[model samples]
Target: MTQPDLSVLDDHFSAMTWGWVGDRGTWTTDAARASLDALEQLGCSWIVLAYATLQATPQSTRIDYAAAPTLTDDEVRWGIRESRRRGWKICLKPVVNVANGTWRGFIGFFDQDVPGEPTWAEWFASYTDYIVHHARIAEEEGVELFVIGCEMVMTDGREAEWRALIERVREVYSGLVTYNCDKYQEDRLTWWDAVDVISASGYYPTGEWPRQLDRIEPVVRRHGKPFLFIEAGCPSRDTSPQRPNDWTLEGAPSGQAQADYLDEMFTACAARDWVGGFALWDWPAALYNPADAAANTDYCMYAKPGEAIVRDYYASRRSG
Candidate 1:
Protein backbone atom coordinates (compact mmCIF):
# COMPACT_ATOMS: atom_id res chain seq x y z
CA MET A 1 0.00 0.00 0.00
CA THR A 2 1.25 3.47 -0.84
CA GLN A 3 1.63 5.93 2.01
CA PRO A 4 -0.88 8.76 2.08
CA ASP A 5 0.52 12.27 2.54
CA LEU A 6 -0.42 13.19 6.13
CA SER A 7 1.04 16.68 6.31
CA VAL A 8 -2.57 17.75 6.78
CA LEU A 9 -2.66 16.45 10.34
CA ASP A 10 0.71 17.96 11.26
CA ASP A 11 -0.62 20.56 13.63
CA HIS A 12 -2.76 17.91 15.30
CA PHE A 13 0.29 15.73 15.80
CA SER A 14 2.56 18.45 17.16
CA ALA A 15 1.75 17.50 20.74
CA MET A 16 -1.15 15.11 20.32
CA THR A 17 -1.82 11.70 21.93
CA TRP A 18 -4.66 9.23 22.44
CA GLY A 19 -5.98 9.38 26.02
CA TRP A 20 -7.58 6.21 27.45
CA VAL A 21 -10.01 6.94 30.32
CA GLY A 22 -11.34 3.47 30.69
CA ASP A 23 -15.14 2.86 30.34
CA ARG A 24 -16.62 6.29 31.07
CA GLY A 25 -20.12 4.95 30.52
CA THR A 26 -19.30 2.79 33.53
CA TRP A 27 -18.04 5.62 35.72
CA THR A 28 -19.75 8.33 37.70
CA THR A 29 -20.25 11.81 36.25
CA ASP A 30 -17.86 13.38 38.74
CA ALA A 31 -15.25 10.76 38.00
CA ALA A 32 -15.40 11.35 34.28
CA ARG A 33 -15.11 15.09 34.72
CA ALA A 34 -12.16 14.72 37.04
CA SER A 35 -10.51 12.30 34.66
CA LEU A 36 -10.82 14.77 31.83
CA ASP A 37 -9.08 17.48 33.82
CA ALA A 38 -6.25 15.13 34.74
CA LEU A 39 -5.87 14.10 31.12
CA GLU A 40 -5.57 17.69 30.01
CA GLN A 41 -2.60 18.19 32.31
CA LEU A 42 -0.97 15.17 30.70
CA GLY A 43 -1.12 16.84 27.24
CA CYS A 44 -4.01 14.83 25.85
CA SER A 45 -5.26 16.71 22.81
CA TRP A 46 -7.96 14.16 22.03
CA ILE A 47 -9.95 11.47 23.76
CA VAL A 48 -11.72 8.28 22.61
CA LEU A 49 -14.45 7.83 25.20
CA ALA A 50 -15.91 4.31 25.37
CA TYR A 51 -19.71 4.36 25.75
CA ALA A 52 -21.14 0.82 25.45
CA THR A 53 -20.65 -2.80 26.49
CA LEU A 54 -21.20 -6.48 25.55
CA GLN A 55 -23.26 -7.82 28.41
CA ALA A 56 -27.01 -7.19 28.83
CA THR A 57 -26.45 -5.42 32.10
CA PRO A 58 -28.13 -2.29 33.38
CA GLN A 59 -24.83 -0.45 33.36
CA SER A 60 -23.93 -1.03 29.70
CA THR A 61 -27.37 -1.17 28.07
CA ARG A 62 -29.17 2.12 27.80
CA ILE A 63 -32.92 2.00 27.20
CA ASP A 64 -33.15 5.76 26.59
CA TYR A 65 -29.74 6.84 25.40
CA ALA A 66 -30.59 10.51 25.61
CA ALA A 67 -31.33 10.23 29.33
CA ALA A 68 -28.87 7.59 30.42
CA PRO A 69 -26.83 9.31 33.12
CA THR A 70 -23.51 7.62 32.49
CA LEU A 71 -23.64 8.37 28.72
CA THR A 72 -26.65 10.56 28.09
CA ASP A 73 -26.47 13.41 25.63
CA ASP A 74 -26.05 15.70 28.60
CA GLU A 75 -22.90 13.90 29.76
CA VAL A 76 -21.47 13.78 26.29
CA ARG A 77 -22.19 17.42 25.83
CA TRP A 78 -20.44 18.14 29.07
CA GLY A 79 -17.30 16.33 27.92
CA ILE A 80 -17.24 18.06 24.55
CA ARG A 81 -17.99 21.44 26.02
CA GLU A 82 -15.19 21.04 28.53
CA SER A 83 -12.80 19.82 25.87
CA ARG A 84 -13.60 22.78 23.67
CA ARG A 85 -13.31 25.09 26.62
CA ARG A 86 -9.81 23.73 27.17
CA GLY A 87 -9.11 23.70 23.43
CA TRP A 88 -9.28 19.95 22.77
CA LYS A 89 -11.08 17.51 20.47
CA ILE A 90 -13.42 14.75 21.62
CA CYS A 91 -13.83 11.46 19.76
CA LEU A 92 -16.82 9.65 21.23
CA LYS A 93 -16.48 5.90 20.66
CA PRO A 94 -19.40 3.78 21.91
CA VAL A 95 -18.12 0.21 21.81
CA VAL A 96 -19.49 -3.31 22.36
CA ASN A 97 -18.03 -6.59 23.79
CA VAL A 98 -16.63 -4.63 26.72
CA ALA A 99 -17.57 -6.89 29.64
CA ASN A 100 -17.16 -10.30 28.05
CA GLY A 101 -14.06 -9.10 26.22
CA THR A 102 -15.45 -9.99 22.80
CA TRP A 103 -13.09 -9.42 19.88
CA ARG A 104 -10.44 -8.17 22.29
CA GLY A 105 -12.65 -5.31 23.51
CA PHE A 106 -13.33 -3.89 20.07
CA ILE A 107 -16.80 -4.80 18.82
CA GLY A 108 -18.43 -5.43 22.14
CA PHE A 109 -20.97 -7.94 20.79
CA PHE A 110 -22.31 -10.99 22.57
CA ASP A 111 -23.06 -14.20 20.75
CA GLN A 112 -26.56 -12.76 20.78
CA ASP A 113 -27.39 -14.40 17.45
CA VAL A 114 -26.86 -18.03 18.40
CA PRO A 115 -29.16 -20.41 20.30
CA GLY A 116 -30.07 -19.13 23.78
CA GLU A 117 -28.46 -15.85 22.76
CA PRO A 118 -29.60 -12.49 21.47
CA THR A 119 -29.73 -12.38 17.70
CA TRP A 120 -26.91 -10.49 15.96
CA ALA A 121 -29.49 -8.51 13.99
CA GLU A 122 -31.21 -7.44 17.18
CA TRP A 123 -27.93 -6.38 18.78
CA PHE A 124 -26.72 -4.67 15.64
CA ALA A 125 -29.99 -2.84 15.23
CA SER A 126 -29.89 -1.57 18.79
CA TYR A 127 -26.24 -0.58 18.42
CA THR A 128 -27.00 1.20 15.19
CA ASP A 129 -29.72 3.17 16.92
CA TYR A 130 -27.34 3.90 19.74
CA ILE A 131 -24.71 5.15 17.29
CA VAL A 132 -27.31 7.39 15.64
CA HIS A 133 -28.16 8.83 19.01
CA HIS A 134 -24.45 9.40 19.63
CA ALA A 135 -24.18 11.25 16.34
CA ARG A 136 -27.03 13.49 17.36
CA ILE A 137 -25.31 14.10 20.66
CA ALA A 138 -22.07 14.86 18.83
CA GLU A 139 -23.92 17.46 16.81
CA GLU A 140 -25.31 18.98 19.96
CA GLU A 141 -21.95 18.85 21.79
CA GLY A 142 -19.79 19.91 18.86
CA VAL A 143 -17.82 16.69 18.98
CA GLU A 144 -15.58 16.56 15.92
CA LEU A 145 -15.26 12.77 15.62
CA PHE A 146 -17.39 9.74 16.43
CA VAL A 147 -16.42 6.07 16.13
CA ILE A 148 -19.16 3.48 15.44
CA GLY A 149 -17.36 0.33 16.51
CA CYS A 150 -13.96 -1.00 17.56
CA GLU A 151 -12.33 -4.42 17.04
CA MET A 152 -15.10 -6.72 15.76
CA VAL A 153 -12.75 -9.21 14.14
CA MET A 154 -14.97 -12.29 14.18
CA THR A 155 -17.84 -10.44 12.53
CA ASP A 156 -15.80 -8.47 9.96
CA GLY A 157 -17.10 -10.76 7.21
CA ARG A 158 -20.34 -8.75 7.39
CA GLU A 159 -18.79 -5.90 5.48
CA ALA A 160 -21.84 -5.00 3.45
CA GLU A 161 -23.93 -4.42 6.57
CA TRP A 162 -21.18 -2.35 8.13
CA ARG A 163 -20.97 -0.11 5.08
CA ALA A 164 -24.68 0.53 5.11
CA LEU A 165 -24.58 1.37 8.78
CA ILE A 166 -21.81 3.92 8.17
CA GLU A 167 -23.90 5.54 5.41
CA ARG A 168 -26.77 5.90 7.84
CA VAL A 169 -24.39 7.49 10.35
CA ARG A 170 -23.38 10.03 7.71
CA GLU A 171 -26.98 11.18 7.57
CA VAL A 172 -26.83 12.32 11.21
CA TYR A 173 -23.19 13.15 12.01
CA SER A 174 -21.96 16.10 10.05
CA GLY A 175 -18.51 15.69 11.57
CA LEU A 176 -16.02 12.93 10.72
CA VAL A 177 -17.10 9.32 11.24
CA THR A 178 -14.77 6.33 11.64
CA TYR A 179 -14.62 2.85 13.13
CA ASN A 180 -11.82 1.32 15.22
CA CYS A 181 -10.36 -1.89 13.82
CA ASP A 182 -7.73 -3.94 15.60
CA LYS A 183 -4.05 -3.92 14.55
CA TYR A 184 -4.31 -6.73 11.96
CA GLN A 185 -7.74 -6.28 10.43
CA GLU A 186 -6.54 -4.39 7.35
CA ASP A 187 -9.01 -6.37 5.24
CA ARG A 188 -11.83 -4.10 6.47
CA LEU A 189 -9.92 -0.91 5.68
CA THR A 190 -11.79 -0.28 2.43
CA TRP A 191 -15.18 -0.51 4.14
CA TRP A 192 -14.29 2.65 6.10
CA ASP A 193 -14.29 5.03 3.12
CA ALA A 194 -17.53 6.49 4.40
CA VAL A 195 -15.48 7.80 7.31
CA ASP A 196 -13.59 11.06 7.17
CA VAL A 197 -10.45 9.39 8.57
CA ILE A 198 -9.19 5.81 8.69
CA SER A 199 -8.33 4.67 12.22
CA ALA A 200 -6.65 1.73 14.00
CA SER A 201 -5.65 0.80 17.50
CA GLY A 202 -1.86 0.31 17.52
CA TYR A 203 -1.08 -1.75 20.60
CA TYR A 204 1.57 -3.95 19.06
CA PRO A 205 4.01 -4.97 21.80
CA THR A 206 6.29 -2.28 23.22
CA GLY A 207 9.28 -3.88 21.53
CA GLU A 208 7.40 -3.53 18.25
CA TRP A 209 7.21 0.24 18.59
CA PRO A 210 8.97 1.99 15.70
CA ARG A 211 8.81 -1.18 13.63
CA GLN A 212 5.10 -1.56 14.31
CA LEU A 213 4.41 1.84 12.82
CA ASP A 214 6.82 1.07 9.99
CA ARG A 215 4.79 -1.99 9.02
CA ILE A 216 1.47 -0.11 9.24
CA GLU A 217 2.72 3.10 7.64
CA PRO A 218 3.03 1.51 4.22
CA VAL A 219 -0.55 0.25 4.27
CA VAL A 220 -1.99 3.40 5.82
CA ARG A 221 -0.20 5.55 3.26
CA ARG A 222 -1.82 3.52 0.52
CA HIS A 223 -5.26 4.51 1.84
CA GLY A 224 -4.29 8.14 1.09
CA LYS A 225 -6.19 9.65 4.02
CA PRO A 226 -5.67 10.89 7.55
CA PHE A 227 -5.31 8.14 10.16
CA LEU A 228 -5.90 8.06 13.88
CA PHE A 229 -4.57 5.78 16.63
CA ILE A 230 -7.98 5.31 18.21
CA GLU A 231 -6.62 3.33 21.13
CA ALA A 232 -3.17 2.75 22.74
CA GLY A 233 -1.40 2.38 26.12
CA CYS A 234 1.97 1.52 27.71
CA PRO A 235 2.60 -0.58 30.78
CA SER A 236 3.31 0.75 34.28
CA ARG A 237 6.26 0.00 36.65
CA ASP A 238 5.23 -3.40 38.04
CA THR A 239 2.82 -5.31 35.85
CA SER A 240 3.21 -9.01 34.99
CA PRO A 241 2.00 -10.85 31.91
CA GLN A 242 -1.15 -12.95 31.77
CA ARG A 243 -0.53 -13.96 28.20
CA PRO A 244 1.58 -12.69 25.32
CA ASN A 245 -0.14 -11.68 22.12
CA ASP A 246 1.22 -9.23 19.55
CA TRP A 247 1.19 -6.59 22.32
CA THR A 248 0.83 -6.46 26.10
CA LEU A 249 1.59 -4.25 29.13
CA GLU A 250 2.88 -7.16 31.13
CA GLY A 251 6.46 -8.12 31.96
CA ALA A 252 7.98 -5.59 29.61
CA PRO A 253 11.16 -3.64 30.39
CA SER A 254 11.40 -0.56 32.64
CA GLY A 255 9.56 2.74 32.37
CA GLN A 256 12.58 4.16 30.53
CA ALA A 257 12.34 1.39 27.98
CA GLN A 258 8.69 2.21 27.46
CA ALA A 259 9.47 5.88 27.13
CA ASP A 260 12.31 5.27 24.69
CA TYR A 261 10.06 3.02 22.64
CA LEU A 262 7.33 5.69 22.44
CA ASP A 263 9.80 8.46 21.68
CA GLU A 264 11.25 6.46 18.82
CA MET A 265 7.79 5.75 17.46
CA PHE A 266 6.60 9.36 17.75
CA THR A 267 9.76 10.72 16.24
CA ALA A 268 9.53 8.30 13.37
CA CYS A 269 5.91 9.29 12.76
CA ALA A 270 6.71 13.00 12.93
CA ALA A 271 9.55 12.57 10.48
CA ARG A 272 7.18 10.96 8.00
CA ASP A 273 5.81 13.50 5.52
CA TRP A 274 2.84 11.33 4.59
CA VAL A 275 1.54 10.23 7.99
CA GLY A 276 -1.05 12.26 9.78
CA GLY A 277 -1.23 12.90 13.55
CA PHE A 278 -1.01 10.08 16.11
CA ALA A 279 -2.49 9.86 19.61
CA LEU A 280 -0.45 8.03 22.22
CA TRP A 281 -2.40 5.20 23.84
CA ASP A 282 -2.69 6.99 27.17
CA TRP A 283 -2.06 9.87 29.61
CA PRO A 284 0.54 10.29 32.35
CA ALA A 285 -0.21 8.61 35.67
CA ALA A 286 -2.59 10.24 38.12
CA LEU A 287 -3.94 9.37 41.54
CA TYR A 288 -7.51 8.56 40.63
CA ASN A 289 -7.09 6.88 37.25
CA PRO A 290 -7.93 3.16 37.24
CA ALA A 291 -4.49 2.15 36.07
CA ASP A 292 -3.11 4.07 39.00
CA ALA A 293 -5.79 2.90 41.41
CA ALA A 294 -5.57 -0.82 40.67
CA ALA A 295 -1.78 -0.55 40.37
CA ASN A 296 -1.83 -2.60 37.14
CA THR A 297 1.84 -1.88 36.56
CA ASP A 298 1.88 -3.03 32.95
CA TYR A 299 0.32 -1.05 30.08
CA CYS A 300 -1.45 2.31 30.57
CA MET A 301 1.27 4.59 31.92
CA TYR A 302 -0.39 7.35 33.93
CA ALA A 303 2.32 8.52 36.38
CA LYS A 304 5.25 6.28 35.67
CA PRO A 305 8.86 7.50 35.42
CA GLY A 306 8.45 7.18 31.65
CA GLU A 307 6.30 10.30 31.84
CA ALA A 308 9.36 12.48 32.52
CA ILE A 309 10.91 11.33 29.27
CA VAL A 310 7.71 11.95 27.31
CA ARG A 311 7.23 15.35 28.89
CA ASP A 312 10.79 16.35 28.11
CA TYR A 313 10.58 15.06 24.55
CA TYR A 314 7.53 17.15 23.80
CA ALA A 315 9.04 20.07 25.59
CA SER A 316 12.00 19.81 23.24
CA ARG A 317 9.64 19.65 20.29
CA ARG A 318 8.05 22.85 21.51
CA SER A 319 11.45 24.52 21.86
CA GLY A 320 12.73 23.46 18.43
Candidate 2:
Protein backbone atom coordinates (compact mmCIF):
# COMPACT_ATOMS: atom_id res chain seq x y z
CA MET A 1 0.00 0.00 0.00
CA THR A 2 3.05 2.26 0.30
CA GLN A 3 4.05 4.53 -2.63
CA PRO A 4 6.06 7.64 -3.55
CA ASP A 5 5.31 10.74 -1.53
CA LEU A 6 3.03 13.26 -3.21
CA SER A 7 3.69 16.37 -1.21
CA VAL A 8 1.28 18.29 -3.41
CA LEU A 9 -1.54 16.39 -1.72
CA ASP A 10 -0.31 17.23 1.78
CA ASP A 11 -2.26 20.43 2.17
CA HIS A 12 -5.63 20.49 3.94
CA PHE A 13 -7.74 19.02 1.14
CA SER A 14 -10.53 21.52 0.92
CA ALA A 15 -12.24 19.14 -1.47
CA MET A 16 -15.68 19.79 -2.95
CA THR A 17 -16.86 16.38 -4.04
CA TRP A 18 -18.80 15.31 -7.14
CA GLY A 19 -19.85 11.69 -6.85
CA TRP A 20 -21.51 9.11 -9.05
CA VAL A 21 -21.74 11.19 -12.23
CA GLY A 22 -23.36 8.09 -13.76
CA ASP A 23 -24.31 9.30 -17.17
CA ARG A 24 -22.06 8.06 -19.97
CA GLY A 25 -21.19 11.32 -21.77
CA THR A 26 -21.93 13.85 -19.04
CA TRP A 27 -18.37 14.81 -18.14
CA THR A 28 -17.53 15.84 -21.72
CA THR A 29 -20.21 18.50 -21.76
CA ASP A 30 -19.86 22.20 -21.11
CA ALA A 31 -22.18 21.91 -18.13
CA ALA A 32 -19.77 19.55 -16.39
CA ARG A 33 -16.85 21.87 -17.10
CA ALA A 34 -18.76 24.86 -15.74
CA SER A 35 -19.59 22.81 -12.66
CA LEU A 36 -15.91 22.12 -12.07
CA ASP A 37 -15.11 25.82 -12.51
CA ALA A 38 -17.79 26.69 -9.99
CA LEU A 39 -16.39 24.16 -7.50
CA GLU A 40 -12.95 25.82 -7.74
CA GLN A 41 -14.41 29.22 -6.78
CA LEU A 42 -15.67 27.78 -3.49
CA GLY A 43 -12.05 28.15 -2.27
CA CYS A 44 -11.51 24.44 -2.73
CA SER A 45 -7.94 23.14 -2.91
CA TRP A 46 -9.01 19.64 -4.00
CA ILE A 47 -11.73 18.12 -6.17
CA VAL A 48 -13.17 14.63 -5.67
CA LEU A 49 -14.34 13.27 -8.98
CA ALA A 50 -16.08 10.01 -8.05
CA TYR A 51 -18.09 7.60 -10.17
CA ALA A 52 -19.78 4.24 -9.66
CA THR A 53 -19.13 1.01 -11.50
CA LEU A 54 -21.73 -1.72 -11.22
CA GLN A 55 -22.05 -5.44 -10.49
CA ALA A 56 -25.30 -7.40 -10.65
CA THR A 57 -25.58 -8.14 -6.94
CA PRO A 58 -23.79 -7.92 -3.63
CA GLN A 59 -22.55 -11.50 -4.06
CA SER A 60 -21.74 -11.05 -7.70
CA THR A 61 -18.12 -11.86 -8.53
CA ARG A 62 -18.10 -9.94 -11.78
CA ILE A 63 -17.73 -6.16 -11.75
CA ASP A 64 -18.87 -4.64 -15.00
CA TYR A 65 -17.14 -1.27 -14.97
CA ALA A 66 -17.32 -0.64 -18.69
CA ALA A 67 -21.07 -1.03 -18.55
CA ALA A 68 -23.17 1.85 -19.92
CA PRO A 69 -23.99 3.22 -16.45
CA THR A 70 -20.45 4.39 -15.73
CA LEU A 71 -18.51 7.30 -17.18
CA THR A 72 -16.00 6.57 -19.95
CA ASP A 73 -12.29 6.49 -19.12
CA ASP A 74 -11.84 9.52 -21.40
CA GLU A 75 -14.37 11.45 -19.32
CA VAL A 76 -12.48 10.56 -16.15
CA ARG A 77 -9.23 11.74 -17.71
CA TRP A 78 -10.81 15.03 -18.81
CA GLY A 79 -11.96 15.61 -15.24
CA ILE A 80 -8.49 14.90 -13.87
CA ARG A 81 -6.87 17.06 -16.56
CA GLU A 82 -9.28 19.95 -16.02
CA SER A 83 -9.01 19.84 -12.23
CA ARG A 84 -5.18 19.78 -12.25
CA ARG A 85 -5.17 22.56 -14.85
CA ARG A 86 -7.18 24.67 -12.42
CA GLY A 87 -4.44 24.11 -9.79
CA TRP A 88 -6.69 21.82 -7.75
CA LYS A 89 -5.60 18.37 -6.60
CA ILE A 90 -7.82 15.60 -7.99
CA CYS A 91 -8.91 12.53 -6.00
CA LEU A 92 -10.23 10.10 -8.54
CA LYS A 93 -12.49 7.76 -6.53
CA PRO A 94 -14.40 5.07 -8.35
CA VAL A 95 -16.85 3.05 -6.25
CA VAL A 96 -18.54 -0.30 -6.74
CA ASN A 97 -22.33 -0.55 -6.70
CA VAL A 98 -24.89 -3.33 -6.90
CA ALA A 99 -27.24 -3.09 -9.87
CA ASN A 100 -29.98 -4.92 -7.97
CA GLY A 101 -30.77 -1.83 -5.93
CA THR A 102 -28.77 -2.94 -2.88
CA TRP A 103 -26.17 -0.96 -0.98
CA ARG A 104 -22.55 -1.67 -1.75
CA GLY A 105 -21.70 -2.14 1.91
CA PHE A 106 -23.54 -5.46 1.79
CA ILE A 107 -21.30 -6.96 -0.87
CA GLY A 108 -20.01 -10.21 0.67
CA PHE A 109 -19.59 -13.94 0.40
CA PHE A 110 -19.30 -17.03 2.64
CA ASP A 111 -16.44 -16.95 5.17
CA GLN A 112 -15.54 -20.42 4.02
CA ASP A 113 -15.80 -21.80 0.48
CA VAL A 114 -19.13 -23.34 -0.57
CA PRO A 115 -19.10 -25.34 -3.71
CA GLY A 116 -20.81 -23.56 -6.66
CA GLU A 117 -21.29 -20.43 -4.57
CA PRO A 118 -19.39 -17.24 -5.39
CA THR A 119 -16.15 -16.75 -3.49
CA TRP A 120 -14.17 -13.76 -2.18
CA ALA A 121 -11.33 -14.91 -4.32
CA GLU A 122 -13.46 -14.54 -7.43
CA TRP A 123 -14.81 -11.16 -6.32
CA PHE A 124 -11.41 -9.66 -5.48
CA ALA A 125 -10.02 -10.71 -8.84
CA SER A 126 -12.64 -8.71 -10.72
CA TYR A 127 -12.57 -5.90 -8.18
CA THR A 128 -8.80 -5.70 -8.43
CA ASP A 129 -9.07 -5.35 -12.19
CA TYR A 130 -11.60 -2.60 -11.74
CA ILE A 131 -9.31 -0.67 -9.38
CA VAL A 132 -6.10 -1.29 -11.34
CA HIS A 133 -7.86 -0.02 -14.46
CA HIS A 134 -8.57 3.30 -12.73
CA ALA A 135 -5.23 3.34 -10.92
CA ARG A 136 -3.47 3.32 -14.28
CA ILE A 137 -5.55 6.28 -15.32
CA ALA A 138 -4.80 8.09 -12.07
CA GLU A 139 -1.11 7.55 -12.71
CA GLU A 140 -1.28 8.68 -16.33
CA GLU A 141 -3.25 11.83 -15.45
CA GLY A 142 -1.04 12.71 -12.46
CA VAL A 143 -3.90 12.61 -10.03
CA GLU A 144 -2.75 13.78 -6.59
CA LEU A 145 -4.71 11.22 -4.61
CA PHE A 146 -6.57 8.04 -5.55
CA VAL A 147 -9.20 6.25 -3.47
CA ILE A 148 -8.96 2.50 -4.05
CA GLY A 149 -12.39 1.60 -2.64
CA CYS A 150 -15.33 3.19 -0.83
CA GLU A 151 -17.64 2.00 1.94
CA MET A 152 -17.35 -1.70 1.23
CA VAL A 153 -18.21 -2.69 4.78
CA MET A 154 -18.65 -6.42 4.47
CA THR A 155 -15.37 -6.74 2.63
CA ASP A 156 -13.39 -4.82 5.26
CA GLY A 157 -12.45 -7.96 7.21
CA ARG A 158 -10.61 -9.39 4.23
CA GLU A 159 -7.32 -7.77 5.18
CA ALA A 160 -5.12 -9.78 2.90
CA GLU A 161 -7.19 -9.06 -0.22
CA TRP A 162 -7.28 -5.35 0.55
CA ARG A 163 -3.53 -5.27 1.06
CA ALA A 164 -3.00 -7.04 -2.24
CA LEU A 165 -5.34 -4.70 -4.06
CA ILE A 166 -3.62 -1.67 -2.59
CA GLU A 167 -0.25 -3.16 -3.48
CA ARG A 168 -1.35 -3.48 -7.09
CA VAL A 169 -2.56 0.09 -7.00
CA ARG A 170 0.78 1.20 -5.58
CA GLU A 171 2.56 -0.31 -8.55
CA VAL A 172 0.52 1.88 -10.90
CA TYR A 173 -0.23 5.06 -8.94
CA SER A 174 2.82 6.86 -7.68
CA GLY A 175 0.82 9.36 -5.63
CA LEU A 176 -1.04 9.09 -2.34
CA VAL A 177 -3.51 6.20 -1.98
CA THR A 178 -6.36 5.72 0.49
CA TYR A 179 -9.27 3.37 1.04
CA ASN A 180 -12.60 4.99 2.09
CA CYS A 181 -14.07 2.85 4.82
CA ASP A 182 -17.66 3.44 5.94
CA LYS A 183 -18.59 5.76 8.79
CA TYR A 184 -17.62 4.47 12.28
CA GLN A 185 -15.11 2.10 10.65
CA GLU A 186 -12.00 4.17 11.31
CA ASP A 187 -11.13 2.09 14.34
CA ARG A 188 -12.51 -1.15 12.95
CA LEU A 189 -9.99 -1.64 10.16
CA THR A 190 -6.77 -3.43 11.10
CA TRP A 191 -4.94 -2.71 7.85
CA TRP A 192 -4.33 1.03 7.97
CA ASP A 193 -0.73 0.26 7.10
CA ALA A 194 -1.89 -0.97 3.70
CA VAL A 195 -2.35 2.57 2.37
CA ASP A 196 -0.54 5.89 2.47
CA VAL A 197 -3.43 7.69 4.20
CA ILE A 198 -6.40 6.80 6.40
CA SER A 199 -9.86 7.99 5.34
CA ALA A 200 -13.51 7.23 6.02
CA SER A 201 -16.98 8.55 5.47
CA GLY A 202 -17.76 11.20 8.15
CA TYR A 203 -21.53 10.99 8.49
CA TYR A 204 -21.94 11.16 12.24
CA PRO A 205 -25.26 12.45 13.57
CA THR A 206 -25.75 15.97 14.94
CA GLY A 207 -24.24 16.61 18.41
CA GLU A 208 -21.99 13.57 18.13
CA TRP A 209 -19.12 15.14 16.18
CA PRO A 210 -16.61 15.53 19.03
CA ARG A 211 -17.32 12.08 20.41
CA GLN A 212 -16.80 10.44 17.01
CA LEU A 213 -13.64 12.43 16.39
CA ASP A 214 -12.43 11.41 19.83
CA ARG A 215 -12.95 7.84 18.71
CA ILE A 216 -11.38 8.25 15.25
CA GLU A 217 -8.36 10.35 16.30
CA PRO A 218 -6.75 7.52 18.25
CA VAL A 219 -6.96 5.28 15.20
CA VAL A 220 -5.12 7.85 13.10
CA ARG A 221 -2.54 8.41 15.84
CA ARG A 222 -2.14 4.70 16.43
CA HIS A 223 -1.39 4.12 12.77
CA GLY A 224 0.68 7.29 12.41
CA LYS A 225 -0.97 8.22 9.13
CA PRO A 226 -2.84 11.26 7.85
CA PHE A 227 -6.66 11.16 7.80
CA LEU A 228 -9.51 12.79 5.96
CA PHE A 229 -13.21 12.34 5.33
CA ILE A 230 -13.50 11.17 1.78
CA GLU A 231 -17.30 11.73 1.88
CA ALA A 232 -19.35 13.99 4.17
CA GLY A 233 -22.38 16.32 3.81
CA CYS A 234 -26.00 16.95 4.76
CA PRO A 235 -28.99 17.16 2.49
CA SER A 236 -31.16 20.29 2.38
CA ARG A 237 -33.88 18.19 4.03
CA ASP A 238 -34.75 19.18 7.60
CA THR A 239 -34.07 15.70 8.95
CA SER A 240 -30.66 15.43 7.33
CA PRO A 241 -28.36 16.76 10.05
CA GLN A 242 -29.66 14.12 12.44
CA ARG A 243 -28.84 11.39 9.93
CA PRO A 244 -26.55 12.88 7.36
CA ASN A 245 -25.91 9.47 5.85
CA ASP A 246 -29.57 8.85 5.04
CA TRP A 247 -30.41 10.49 1.75
CA THR A 248 -33.86 8.92 1.69
CA LEU A 249 -35.13 10.58 4.88
CA GLU A 250 -38.37 12.50 4.34
CA GLY A 251 -38.46 16.20 5.14
CA ALA A 252 -38.99 19.62 3.56
CA PRO A 253 -35.97 21.13 1.83
CA SER A 254 -34.29 23.76 3.97
CA GLY A 255 -30.91 25.18 3.04
CA GLN A 256 -30.48 26.54 6.56
CA ALA A 257 -30.66 23.02 7.97
CA GLN A 258 -27.85 21.97 5.72
CA ALA A 259 -25.83 25.08 6.59
CA ASP A 260 -26.35 24.51 10.30
CA TYR A 261 -25.00 20.99 9.98
CA LEU A 262 -21.95 22.19 8.08
CA ASP A 263 -21.42 24.97 10.61
CA GLU A 264 -21.36 22.51 13.51
CA MET A 265 -19.28 20.05 11.50
CA PHE A 266 -16.62 22.59 10.58
CA THR A 267 -16.52 24.14 14.04
CA ALA A 268 -15.98 20.80 15.70
CA CYS A 269 -13.47 19.60 13.12
CA ALA A 270 -11.55 22.89 13.19
CA ALA A 271 -10.37 22.12 16.71
CA ARG A 272 -8.78 18.81 15.72
CA ASP A 273 -5.66 19.13 13.58
CA TRP A 274 -5.61 15.45 12.62
CA VAL A 275 -9.11 15.63 11.23
CA GLY A 276 -8.30 16.76 7.68
CA GLY A 277 -10.94 18.64 5.68
CA PHE A 278 -13.77 17.02 3.76
CA ALA A 279 -15.00 16.21 0.32
CA LEU A 280 -18.65 17.18 0.55
CA TRP A 281 -21.15 14.61 -0.77
CA ASP A 282 -21.74 16.30 -4.12
CA TRP A 283 -22.07 19.10 -6.60
CA PRO A 284 -23.91 17.69 -9.59
CA ALA A 285 -22.56 17.21 -13.11
CA ALA A 286 -25.56 19.20 -14.40
CA LEU A 287 -26.40 21.91 -11.91
CA TYR A 288 -29.93 22.72 -10.90
CA ASN A 289 -31.40 26.16 -11.54
CA PRO A 290 -30.16 28.61 -8.92
CA ALA A 291 -33.58 29.98 -8.06
CA ASP A 292 -34.80 26.51 -7.09
CA ALA A 293 -32.08 25.89 -4.53
CA ALA A 294 -34.46 25.97 -1.57
CA ALA A 295 -36.72 23.32 -3.12
CA ASN A 296 -33.99 20.88 -4.02
CA THR A 297 -33.64 18.32 -1.21
CA ASP A 298 -30.69 16.16 -2.27
CA TYR A 299 -27.10 16.87 -1.05
CA CYS A 300 -25.87 19.05 -3.94
CA MET A 301 -24.85 22.39 -2.39
CA TYR A 302 -25.17 24.41 -5.56
CA ALA A 303 -26.53 27.89 -4.85
CA LYS A 304 -27.60 26.80 -1.36
CA PRO A 305 -26.74 28.70 1.79
CA GLY A 306 -24.61 25.67 2.72
CA GLU A 307 -22.35 26.49 -0.21
CA ALA A 308 -21.59 29.78 1.50
CA ILE A 309 -20.85 27.92 4.73
CA VAL A 310 -18.37 25.71 2.88
CA ARG A 311 -16.78 28.66 1.07
CA ASP A 312 -16.32 30.63 4.28
CA TYR A 313 -14.92 27.60 6.13
CA TYR A 314 -12.49 26.69 3.36
CA ALA A 315 -11.50 30.36 2.98
CA SER A 316 -10.72 30.58 6.68
CA ARG A 317 -8.48 27.55 6.37
CA ARG A 318 -6.50 29.37 3.69
CA SER A 319 -6.26 32.77 5.44
CA GLY A 320 -5.87 31.54 9.02
Best by lDDT: 2
lDDT of 2 by residue, 1-320 (tens): 34468466565779878746556888878888888777777988888988888899899999888888888898888888888889887888998888898999999999999999999999999999999999999988888789999999999999999999988888888888899999999999999988888999999999999999999988988888888998999999999999999989999899999999999999999999987778888888888888998899989888999999999998888887
lDDT scores of the candidates, listed in order: 0.56, 0.88
Candidate 2: C-alpha lDDT: 0.88
Off by over 4 Å in 2: 1-3
lDDT of model 2, residue 192: 94
Going through the candidates in order, what is the number of backbone clashes in each? 26, 0
| Model 2, position 22: C-alpha lDDT score | 52
Find the 10 residues in a row with the least total lDDT in model 1.
Answer: 237-246
The TM-scores, one per candidate, come to: 0.74, 0.97
